[model samples]
Target: MRAAKRRTSREVRTGNRFAVLRAMYALGTPTRQELAGATGLSFATIATMVTELLAVGVVTEASREDSGGGRPRSRLKVAAGRGLLVGVDATETYVHVDVFDLAMTRLVHHDHAVGEGTSDPDRMVGEIAEGVRSALAAAPDGDVLGVGVSLPGQVEPDSGVSLFAPGWGWKDVAAQALLEERLDLPVHVDNPLKATTVAELWFGHGRRVAHLVTVNLGTGIGAGIALDGQLVRGATNNAGEWGHTTLVMDGRPCRCGRDGCLEAYIGVPGLMAQFGERHPGHRYLEGGSQTHFLAAVREGLEADEPEAHELVELFGEQLGVGLANLINMVNPNLVVLTSWAARDLGRWLLPVAEARMRREAINGSAAVVDIVTSAVPTNPVSTGMAAFVLEGFLERVGLPSPTSAPLRRLAEA
Candidate 1:
């Protein structure tokens, strides 16, 4: 009974420490008094916890500011560089790696191109490993705790295997194990879109939104849905596979071997194909340069090509129509758009898409749904993957969760 009581006491103390740390971090640079107030802890408790954290270099004094015209109070923030995190983005065009500190700041990033339609899973994993090595070498410090990878395919959360990445022509590949063997570090893998959503929930708009959907429009379309502040990976861990949702019955064939899928219409190739059908005699999409296709379309429109504007409207309308179904069904507070189509052409696509969504949604769900581009800038997917590993490392130190056991092991070492 005495031992039980002691264990309970330790647990409570640990919980309180975590609560104080989270409050301090969320406030960015909160004073001891602010942390006490935010965490509902007594001043003495906050003082004790802060001192312990500061002594160990977990939290640092960021600045000093006068409080209410009185003596300057010390401002505290998380020590961003306490541990190193590595992230790999197994994308279609390139296998990108990003290194970050505990505070989710990218220290260095590099890209290694992989030829499109590379079917050999071993080759793909090798490229990702190379990127990881490059990132690790570039880090200011060499104490990398863990690795997180974002694949453009379905990844099983439990086993961390790449279920499928059509672009890579991979299926049921042991990506996590492959990476672990190469880097000898903890690894967490997930779909790129889902990884981005996880990052947003922890650091970006997630502070305000309890329910949100981030639609990634790249080689294929997929959504990362967070409902009630939890990233929902459905029964099969493919809950937000919005790209393959049916758009037009028996229309165009999609790369996923489906007819009239949304991805078939608005995917990089699909959009280019749609433009070609509308305008004809266009020498584009030949070399898989989606950027060139977009530039040409934009150029034609800039030169007052009515057909170009019409093509833009059609693309936006189709995308909006698809999103309207999602808004009506999910009733999300916000819809974040990513990828070149949504990122570069968002200003033009958003308005038109929102208008169409509002007009098409069954109820007034669209009226309340805010459509915007992702708040996370440049390499959002890779950055998010880095956050995945970094958060794991931080959580073991009583910061945030859900913690990665392997990451905890590496951090301890």
Candidate 2:
């Protein structure tokens, strides 16, 4: 019982330190009083944590902030050059890697294209490693703390094994182990659903809202759910597979081998299929590339082409049903539509979908839910994955105290 109590005490201190660090990152150079307000910790606790962080060089004092009638309080910021984090977003079509500082400022970017319709796990892993190496090459000198990869599927939380990737027909792929072997750095792997949701919670539309749902529409589809300002990962950490839910009985087939799935109608492939039905054998279909086809569609939509208008109207209707179902069921205060498809078409598609959603969702839920496109400045998936790497780094750092192993392991270097 004493051992357990000690363990619990260490965990609580670690959590409190992490909370302080996260608040510091988010608030820029904030005073101790401001951090206390942001993290809901007492001012005394914030001051103690800040002193420890400063002693270890994890944080540094900035210019003092003068109160109206009292002594000036010193501001604090994360030591930007302490370490580096690499984020990889590997989907069915491409691999994008970005290197970020401790403050989450992206410093290097690299991209590697996967072969059209490539599904072989080995080839995809190679592409991902190549992209990560390219980003690391351009990054400034620092110990690369870790690589956080956003893969496209349900990932086993404990082992970092990709349990399923329907698009690539992957099953039980040892993604994290393979990448760590190739890159010789610690790798943290997760699905894009969780990564993007974390990005939104930290820096995007969901930051201020307690209940939020992010609907990702890319080569695939899924939902990232957050309730009470915490990410909801169910048993097995696969709670947000809303794309597989049935939207229409006996409707179009989905890549997951299901009929009438929400993904079947709104994912990139689904939107491409709908576009093909309208303009079969059109010039945009020559390459059989969804990205190329969507680019053409975006151009057409910008010009207000009649066919594009018709296609968007249909797309809006289908997406509306998906959003309405999510809103009614989850009752999120904010619903952010994101990923390649939404990024490309959301300008024209969001209003239509929002109008349709209001009609379908419950009045109370619909009235409160604000549906908007993702506003994250950087790639949401990669940025969120990088956040994971930072979290891991701090976990190793632990809390600054005599009993705590402050500056041990990677933090010491």
Candidate 3:
């Protein structure tokens, strides 16, 4: 009989694999010796791990490079196309689903309009499941490694549950487990802002920064923080609750039953409320056809409507005030503005917002931090969800587990 294989400590195996994956991701394409050096692992150990990775088709070897005084060295890179991950974003008005490879390249995307005030969680999840299935069917010879769902609420990733989603009327819903049961794959769940932050950290402006804040202004305003290169999911997985932060006490009421919350002033409804108050006859739908409103604003510029300009300026100032508070608290190296508002109002409103931020932010912090718009412009939520799923796949398949200590040690080494 074959000797029973002894199992190693889960922590050790996880740590070692994570180290190797980190080195691979950082180096892009590295030789065995280079990867060993980068990961602080012995050359022999790295060689064994690389061999296993190649066997599993998670990584591939490239053409050898010849050195002046030694044998040729073989380069290794992630086999991006070997597997795919599915991501779904279920919002109040729309449901978006996308499929991406391990390399985080989008393969297919699908979107559908969801009726407003449809707070039935089961029905919404079913619709999302259908969309994800459709997206997967469109993919070419790709096997799904995992699924990630991004929503507008507090999520507990470990439990695969949405603790609360006021908009969806969901409480403690096992979103990930439900998706996994339907799709027959591992699932990861996160808030839209957190997902967007992950996407930013990997491929957007946050890539080069150690600490960053991503503020998403859309149907609602929310934030995600990456402090010292780690995504800060608080004890309850609701760390960056900037939306609920009171900007004005006893002001406008928010959906979360709070008065004068930041979301009440900067969210889509707030903008439309301001528009309606100013232009009583103008019919604009909140969170619907924002392009129409933006067009109207452009036309107003041509017609020189003072009210339109004033509303835009006011929106900028309010946004700036909230951002200034965040800047003072986090003191991030970078701050990214995401969602439809940022895309539409960024150029016109950024200067105003920046001016306010400069006025309120701590001395020199304003100058040190780079406040910019999100690079992933089209369907950021969908892209972010895809990135989140890909990261989970990476972790599941012994690529890398995202942890602060290991990453810090690797950087130092």
Q: For residues 54-132, write the lDDT of model 2, one tens digit per residue.
A: 8766799878877888998888888888789898899888899999987788999998778767888877888899898
True-vs-predicted CA distance for residue 31, candidate 1, Å: 3.8
Return the candidate ranking by TM-score, descending. Answer: 2, 3, 1
Better of 1 and 3 by TM-score: 3
How do the residues 33-142 of candidate 1 rate in per-residue lDDT, one tens digit apiece? 88776656789988987887887677899999878888889999988878887877777767888887766677898887777676687777788888888878877965
Residue ranges of candidate 1 with Cα displaced over 4 Å: 1-26, 32-57, 60-74, 299-304, 394-400, 403-413
Per-residue lDDT of 344 in model 2? 89
After superposing candidate 2 on the true structure, give the runs of residues whose Cα lies further than 4 Å from its correct spot: 1-13, 65-72, 399-413
lDDT string, candidate 3, 1-413, tens digits: 56654435664555556557556766788899887776667888788778867876878986689876798889988888889877787887778888877766678889887776777767887888889888988998877787878878888888888888877778988888777787787888889888888767556654466788899977778999888656777767788999899999999988888899999888877777767777776744434554566656656655777866787788889998999999988998888998767877677778888899999898878888878899864466777676666557666666654433133434343
Which whole-number lDDT from 0 to 100 does residue 142 have in model 2?
A: 94
In terms of lDDT, which candidate is strongest? 2
The C-alpha TM-scores of every prediction are 0.82, 0.91, 0.86
Q: What lDDT would each prediction earn against the true structure?
A: 0.75, 0.81, 0.77
